[model samples]
Target: MRLLRLPEVMYLTALSRSNLYRKIQAGTFPAAARTGSNSVAWVEEEVLAWIQARIDERGLPDTP
Candidate 1:
Protein backbone atom coordinates (compact mmCIF):
# COMPACT_ATOMS: atom_id res chain seq x y z
CA MET A 1 0.00 0.00 0.00
CA ARG A 2 2.43 2.60 -1.21
CA LEU A 3 1.50 6.18 -1.87
CA LEU A 4 3.03 7.98 -4.86
CA ARG A 5 3.81 11.67 -4.97
CA LEU A 6 3.00 13.98 -7.87
CA PRO A 7 6.36 13.66 -9.58
CA GLU A 8 6.28 9.88 -9.38
CA VAL A 9 2.75 9.77 -10.69
CA MET A 10 3.63 12.12 -13.56
CA TYR A 11 6.62 9.98 -14.47
CA LEU A 12 4.66 6.75 -14.38
CA THR A 13 1.64 8.09 -16.23
CA ALA A 14 3.51 10.43 -18.60
CA LEU A 15 1.02 13.14 -17.83
CA SER A 16 1.63 16.78 -17.07
CA ARG A 17 0.29 18.33 -13.90
CA SER A 18 -2.60 20.12 -15.53
CA ASN A 19 -3.62 17.07 -17.57
CA LEU A 20 -3.55 14.89 -14.50
CA TYR A 21 -5.73 17.30 -12.60
CA ARG A 22 -8.06 17.53 -15.56
CA LYS A 23 -8.50 13.78 -15.68
CA ILE A 24 -9.03 13.68 -11.95
CA GLN A 25 -11.73 16.31 -12.20
CA ALA A 26 -13.32 14.41 -15.06
CA GLY A 27 -13.32 11.26 -12.92
CA THR A 28 -11.27 9.40 -15.44
CA PHE A 29 -8.35 9.16 -13.06
CA PRO A 30 -8.04 8.20 -9.43
CA ALA A 31 -8.30 10.91 -6.82
CA ALA A 32 -5.40 11.75 -4.56
CA ALA A 33 -5.47 11.16 -0.85
CA ARG A 34 -4.69 14.00 1.53
CA THR A 35 -1.47 13.21 3.32
CA GLY A 36 -0.95 16.44 5.18
CA SER A 37 -2.00 20.07 5.36
CA ASN A 38 -0.36 20.74 2.02
CA SER A 39 0.43 17.30 0.72
CA VAL A 40 -1.46 14.74 -1.28
CA ALA A 41 -0.56 11.40 -2.81
CA TRP A 42 -2.14 8.72 -4.91
CA VAL A 43 -2.47 5.07 -4.05
CA GLU A 44 0.06 3.16 -6.15
CA GLU A 45 -2.26 0.28 -6.88
CA GLU A 46 -5.09 2.53 -8.02
CA VAL A 47 -2.84 4.38 -10.45
CA LEU A 48 -1.51 1.10 -11.79
CA ALA A 49 -5.01 -0.21 -12.23
CA TRP A 50 -5.95 2.94 -14.15
CA ILE A 51 -3.00 2.43 -16.43
CA GLN A 52 -3.87 -1.22 -16.95
CA ALA A 53 -7.45 -0.23 -17.77
CA ARG A 54 -6.20 2.16 -20.46
CA ILE A 55 -4.14 -0.64 -21.95
CA ASP A 56 -7.10 -2.95 -21.88
CA GLU A 57 -9.25 -0.36 -23.58
CA ARG A 58 -6.70 0.00 -26.33
CA GLY A 59 -6.76 -3.73 -26.88
CA LEU A 60 -10.51 -3.87 -27.21
CA PRO A 61 -12.10 -3.88 -30.64
CA ASP A 62 -13.96 -0.74 -31.59
CA THR A 63 -17.68 -1.16 -31.96
CA PRO A 64 -19.48 0.61 -34.71
Candidate 2:
Protein backbone atom coordinates (compact mmCIF):
# COMPACT_ATOMS: atom_id res chain seq x y z
CA MET A 1 0.00 0.00 0.00
CA ARG A 2 1.24 3.42 -0.88
CA LEU A 3 1.34 6.30 1.59
CA LEU A 4 1.74 10.01 0.89
CA ARG A 5 2.94 12.96 2.87
CA LEU A 6 0.64 15.95 3.38
CA PRO A 7 2.43 18.14 0.87
CA GLU A 8 2.40 15.51 -1.84
CA VAL A 9 -1.22 14.68 -1.12
CA MET A 10 -2.13 18.36 -1.14
CA TYR A 11 -0.46 18.79 -4.51
CA LEU A 12 -2.23 15.76 -5.87
CA THR A 13 -5.65 16.82 -4.58
CA ALA A 14 -5.21 20.56 -5.05
CA LEU A 15 -6.28 21.28 -1.47
CA SER A 16 -4.55 23.47 1.03
CA ARG A 17 -3.24 21.75 4.15
CA SER A 18 -5.74 23.59 6.36
CA ASN A 19 -8.64 22.57 4.17
CA LEU A 20 -7.49 18.98 4.27
CA TYR A 21 -7.39 19.08 8.06
CA ARG A 22 -10.84 20.63 8.19
CA LYS A 23 -12.24 17.96 5.89
CA ILE A 24 -10.69 15.31 8.07
CA GLN A 25 -12.22 16.84 11.20
CA ALA A 26 -15.58 16.92 9.49
CA GLY A 27 -15.21 13.23 8.67
CA THR A 28 -15.42 13.93 4.97
CA PHE A 29 -12.04 12.41 4.25
CA PRO A 30 -10.00 9.61 5.64
CA ALA A 31 -7.60 10.68 8.37
CA ALA A 32 -3.90 10.11 8.04
CA ALA A 33 -2.36 7.45 10.15
CA ARG A 34 0.42 8.65 12.39
CA THR A 35 3.78 7.14 11.60
CA GLY A 36 5.68 9.13 14.20
CA SER A 37 5.21 12.05 16.58
CA ASN A 38 6.05 14.46 13.78
CA SER A 39 5.14 12.34 10.80
CA VAL A 40 1.83 11.38 9.30
CA ALA A 41 0.73 9.90 6.02
CA TRP A 42 -2.45 8.81 4.33
CA VAL A 43 -3.22 5.62 2.55
CA GLU A 44 -2.92 6.49 -1.13
CA GLU A 45 -5.97 4.50 -2.10
CA GLU A 46 -8.14 6.34 0.39
CA VAL A 47 -6.91 9.72 -0.71
CA LEU A 48 -7.44 8.88 -4.35
CA ALA A 49 -10.93 7.63 -3.62
CA TRP A 50 -11.76 10.90 -1.88
CA ILE A 51 -10.52 12.83 -4.85
CA GLN A 52 -12.54 10.65 -7.16
CA ALA A 53 -15.66 11.34 -5.12
CA ARG A 54 -15.08 15.07 -5.47
CA ILE A 55 -14.63 14.71 -9.19
CA ASP A 56 -17.80 12.69 -9.52
CA GLU A 57 -19.83 15.16 -7.51
CA ARG A 58 -18.47 18.33 -9.06
CA GLY A 59 -17.97 16.96 -12.55
CA LEU A 60 -14.37 18.10 -12.38
CA PRO A 61 -12.20 16.61 -15.06
CA ASP A 62 -9.49 14.29 -13.89
CA THR A 63 -6.17 16.00 -13.42
CA PRO A 64 -3.85 15.26 -16.29
Candidate 3:
Protein backbone atom coordinates (compact mmCIF):
# COMPACT_ATOMS: atom_id res chain seq x y z
CA MET A 1 0.00 0.00 0.00
CA ARG A 2 2.83 2.32 -0.75
CA LEU A 3 2.46 5.59 -2.59
CA LEU A 4 5.26 6.18 -5.02
CA ARG A 5 6.59 9.64 -5.68
CA LEU A 6 7.50 11.03 -9.10
CA PRO A 7 11.14 9.97 -9.14
CA GLU A 8 10.28 6.43 -8.18
CA VAL A 9 7.58 6.22 -10.84
CA MET A 10 9.92 7.65 -13.44
CA TYR A 11 12.64 5.18 -12.47
CA LEU A 12 10.32 2.19 -12.57
CA THR A 13 8.73 3.18 -15.88
CA ALA A 14 11.93 4.44 -17.49
CA LEU A 15 10.01 7.53 -18.54
CA SER A 16 11.01 11.13 -18.31
CA ARG A 17 8.80 13.56 -16.44
CA SER A 18 7.51 15.21 -19.58
CA ASN A 19 6.53 11.94 -21.22
CA LEU A 20 4.92 10.76 -18.02
CA TYR A 21 2.79 13.88 -17.81
CA ARG A 22 1.87 13.50 -21.46
CA LYS A 23 0.66 9.98 -20.86
CA ILE A 24 -1.27 11.10 -17.85
CA GLN A 25 -2.89 13.89 -19.81
CA ALA A 26 -3.76 11.50 -22.60
CA GLY A 27 -5.45 9.19 -20.14
CA THR A 28 -2.94 6.46 -20.88
CA PHE A 29 -1.43 6.42 -17.38
CA PRO A 30 -2.77 6.35 -13.88
CA ALA A 31 -3.59 9.70 -12.41
CA ALA A 32 -1.74 10.90 -9.34
CA ALA A 33 -3.44 11.30 -6.00
CA ARG A 34 -3.20 14.61 -4.25
CA THR A 35 -1.35 13.97 -1.03
CA GLY A 36 -1.23 17.49 0.32
CA SER A 37 -1.55 21.11 -0.65
CA ASN A 38 1.47 20.80 -2.85
CA SER A 39 2.24 17.12 -3.19
CA VAL A 40 1.01 14.13 -5.11
CA ALA A 41 1.76 10.43 -5.23
CA TRP A 42 0.78 7.38 -7.26
CA VAL A 43 -0.52 4.14 -5.90
CA GLU A 44 2.22 1.51 -6.22
CA GLU A 45 -0.11 -1.25 -7.27
CA GLU A 46 -1.63 0.85 -10.03
CA VAL A 47 1.78 1.65 -11.43
CA LEU A 48 2.81 -1.96 -11.31
CA ALA A 49 -0.40 -2.98 -13.01
CA TRP A 50 0.27 -0.46 -15.73
CA ILE A 51 3.70 -1.97 -16.26
CA GLN A 52 2.21 -5.44 -16.34
CA ALA A 53 -0.31 -4.26 -18.92
CA ARG A 54 2.51 -3.09 -21.13
CA ILE A 55 4.17 -6.48 -20.85
CA ASP A 56 0.89 -8.18 -21.53
CA GLU A 57 0.53 -6.09 -24.67
CA ARG A 58 3.73 -7.69 -25.91
CA GLY A 59 2.27 -11.13 -25.21
CA LEU A 60 5.16 -11.91 -22.90
CA PRO A 61 4.97 -14.47 -20.16
CA ASP A 62 5.29 -13.42 -16.56
CA THR A 63 8.86 -13.40 -15.34
CA PRO A 64 10.39 -13.09 -11.97
Candidate 4:
Protein backbone atom coordinates (compact mmCIF):
# COMPACT_ATOMS: atom_id res chain seq x y z
CA MET A 1 0.00 0.00 0.00
CA ARG A 2 2.89 2.28 -0.49
CA LEU A 3 2.52 5.47 -2.48
CA LEU A 4 5.15 6.49 -5.02
CA ARG A 5 5.81 10.11 -5.84
CA LEU A 6 6.03 11.50 -9.38
CA PRO A 7 9.76 11.18 -9.78
CA GLU A 8 9.79 7.63 -8.53
CA VAL A 9 6.90 6.66 -10.75
CA MET A 10 8.59 8.32 -13.70
CA TYR A 11 11.77 6.39 -13.06
CA LEU A 12 9.97 3.10 -12.59
CA THR A 13 7.72 3.49 -15.62
CA ALA A 14 10.25 5.27 -17.81
CA LEU A 15 7.57 7.74 -18.80
CA SER A 16 8.04 11.45 -18.89
CA ARG A 17 5.78 13.67 -16.80
CA SER A 18 3.69 14.76 -19.74
CA ASN A 19 3.48 11.23 -21.09
CA LEU A 20 2.18 9.92 -17.79
CA TYR A 21 -0.48 12.60 -17.70
CA ARG A 22 -1.41 11.78 -21.28
CA LYS A 23 -1.80 8.10 -20.49
CA ILE A 24 -3.92 8.91 -17.47
CA GLN A 25 -6.16 11.11 -19.56
CA ALA A 26 -6.39 8.41 -22.20
CA GLY A 27 -7.24 5.79 -19.56
CA THR A 28 -4.19 3.74 -20.47
CA PHE A 29 -2.42 4.22 -17.17
CA PRO A 30 -3.24 4.22 -13.46
CA ALA A 31 -4.60 7.39 -11.93
CA ALA A 32 -2.92 9.16 -9.06
CA ALA A 33 -4.39 9.63 -5.63
CA ARG A 34 -4.61 13.09 -4.21
CA THR A 35 -2.49 13.24 -1.07
CA GLY A 36 -2.94 16.89 -0.16
CA SER A 37 -3.98 20.28 -1.40
CA ASN A 38 -1.07 20.23 -3.83
CA SER A 39 0.28 16.69 -4.00
CA VAL A 40 -0.53 13.40 -5.68
CA ALA A 41 0.95 9.93 -5.95
CA TRP A 42 0.40 6.47 -7.38
CA VAL A 43 0.06 3.14 -5.63
CA GLU A 44 3.28 1.17 -5.70
CA GLU A 45 1.58 -2.16 -6.31
CA GLU A 46 -0.48 -0.77 -9.15
CA VAL A 47 2.58 0.60 -10.86
CA LEU A 48 4.42 -2.63 -10.38
CA ALA A 49 1.50 -4.58 -11.74
CA TRP A 50 1.41 -2.26 -14.71
CA ILE A 51 5.06 -3.04 -15.30
CA GLN A 52 4.39 -6.72 -15.01
CA ALA A 53 1.56 -6.39 -17.46
CA ARG A 54 3.94 -4.83 -19.89
CA ILE A 55 6.32 -7.71 -19.46
CA ASP A 56 3.46 -10.13 -19.87
CA GLU A 57 2.66 -8.41 -23.15
CA ARG A 58 5.99 -9.50 -24.57
CA GLY A 59 5.69 -11.52 -27.83
CA LEU A 60 1.97 -10.83 -28.09
CA PRO A 61 0.60 -9.90 -31.48
CA ASP A 62 0.19 -6.21 -32.05
CA THR A 63 -3.14 -4.71 -32.94
CA PRO A 64 -3.50 -3.22 -36.34
Q: Give residue 61's lDDT in candidate 4 (0 to 100).
A: 71
lDDT of each: 0.97, 0.93, 0.98, 0.95
Please report how far candidate 3 places residue 44 from its true position, in Å: 0.2
Please provide TM-scores, in order, for all candidate models, with all chains considered together: 0.91, 0.85, 0.92, 0.89
Q: Model 1's lDDT to the true fold?
A: 0.97
Q: Where in model 4 is the C-alpha error above 4 Å?
A: 60-64
Q: In candidate 3, what are the lDDT values of residues 1-64, reduced to their tens digit?
A: 9999999999999999999999999999999999999999999999999998998899767789
lDDT for each residue of candidate 4 in 7-33, tens digit (9 for 90 to 100): 999999999999999999999899999
For model 1, residues 1-64, the per-residue Cα lDDT tens digits are 9999999999999999999999999999999999999999999999999998988878787668
Listed per candidate, the RMSD to the true structure in angstroms reads 4.4, 3.2, 1.5, 5.1
Candidate 3's displacement at residue 20, Å, is: 0.3
Please report how far candidate 3 places residue 17 from its true position, in Å: 0.3
**In each prediction, how many residue pairs overlap at the backbone (N, C-alpha, C within less than 3 A)?**
0, 0, 0, 0
Measured by lDDT, the strongest candidate is 3
Judge candidate 4 against the unseen true structure and give its global Cα lDDT, from 0 to 1: 0.95
Residue 54, candidate 2: Cα error in Å is 1.0
Q: Quick one: ranking by lDDT, best first?
A: 3, 1, 4, 2
Ranking by TM-score: 3, 1, 4, 2
- Candidates 1 and 2: which is better by TM-score? 1
lDDT of 2 by residue, 1-64 (tens): 9999999999998999999999999999899999999999999999999988887998767788
Model 2 alpha-carbon drift over 4 Å, by segment: 59-64
- Model 3 C-alpha RMSD vs. true structure (Å) is 1.5
